[model samples]
Target: MNEMNETGAHCHGDAAARVAEISGLFVSIRQILAQMIDGIGVPDARTPKTIIAKLSELQSAHLKVLAAEEAFHAQQDAVGGADTIDMETIRADIRGQLDRIRAAQDAGPLSGGAE
Candidate 1:
């Protein structure tokens, strides 16, 4: 039926939109990780504090992404179809980036050396 087809199309479109939004969040987290990595070699006294602040920011963004993904999953479930996105893989990637950021913080200078 034409109505059924239209509904199906709408669901697919919705799934695609959610995927795009999740992908953008992943990109944002990766950018934060890149910034943390770049900060590693800076010799300023406040570099550690700055990195910690950025890590906190990254965690906050990560929580938002997770919440969005959960909502997306719920929507998909309501539509009754297989998931269009591999949420587990995306979560693993995010975790890995977070781990790397934590490692960088651990390896960074501890003393408040002169900037």
Candidate 2:
């Protein structure tokens, strides 16, 4: 039996589950983008900068998904695979992403925008 890691996440022999978790994140990202496009709640609420900011977050999510997939693959213990994952690079990306998100939120919503 595999013991759960300190984060309560399954370790070893759980590649499939980890992949499924990544898939779920992708689904959420799609839903968020759709909502932003449809503007279902507020008419003309999305500002130009707001859209850009959201895209920044999208990029952040993209990097995370890429890293997750890389980690998932490496966990498989395959004979041949891509280079090992770099924890430092991933951490740096997330820090930058957080800054972008905060700046985006600072831009706030607009009273008038594309409807």
Candidate 3:
């Protein structure tokens, strides 16, 4: 059963790694959002444009993470049907990332107005 244990450990380790990577992506997105907010007062469109580009890059990374998470879920479900896994934390993180992105989008483009 040592091989089984090793396999299980590997699976868990992989899952944890995925979670950590996704979490880091979300954190980076949040940081970009904050940077964008700070960009609002820069009085230069170029600054905000750079910030927006960074945000877009973060968004792309987030999408990639979401895709990987979805693939992981699909594989787990295929292996064990509905009893496959508890991916709630990962799902929650994805949702949180989405909400933050939406909020940042809704905040509107950076403005030159005074604080």
Candidate 4:
């Protein structure tokens, strides 16, 4: 887990928006793992350590993508660009990742390894 420094009191409007963002993050994570599992579909069903490492790397990248999105949103808000937030574009990008994850899942277990 990454460390977040909490200094000033945090402020946010619209509880629903916060909830939505959190929900999206979790859904994205789930989708990512599911895709990994699918791509690495177990004839043996147990992910070996190396495969697990790859999954962790993928998760880290996914989190970075989410954090970057949040940072972009914050920056836009700070600069009065909130109205220009291209939610559709963001969603589309996420959808693309999800699709890739699914394809990877379909690729079956990692090759050249004893799980």
Which 10-residue span in candidate 1 carries the lowest summed lDDT?
34-43
Question: What lDDT is reached at residue 90 by model 4?
Answer: 79
RMSD of 2: 25.1
lDDT at 106, model 2: 95
Q: lDDT tens string, model 2, 1-115? A: 1342333333423655666776777668667756654552333446476666665666576667667667756765663322355546876898899999999899999679889
In candidate 3, how many Å is residue 96 off?
41
Whose lDDT is higher: candidate 2's or candidate 3's? 3
Model 2 stretches with alpha carbons more than 4 Å out: 1-47, 78-115
Candidates' RMSD to native: 27.3, 25.1, 26.0, 26.8
lDDT score for residue 19 of model 2: 62
Q: List the residue pairs that clash in candidate 3.
A: none
Candidate 1 residue 93 Cα shift, in angstroms, is: 38
Runs off by more than 4 Å, candidate 1: 42-115
- Candidate 1, residue 111: Cα displacement in angstroms equals 90
- Least well predicted 10-residue stretch by lDDT in candidate 2: 1-10
Q: After best superposition, candidate 2 residue 84: deviation in angstroms?
A: 21
What's each prediction's TM-score?
0.37, 0.31, 0.37, 0.35
Residue-level lDDT for 81 in candidate 3: 37
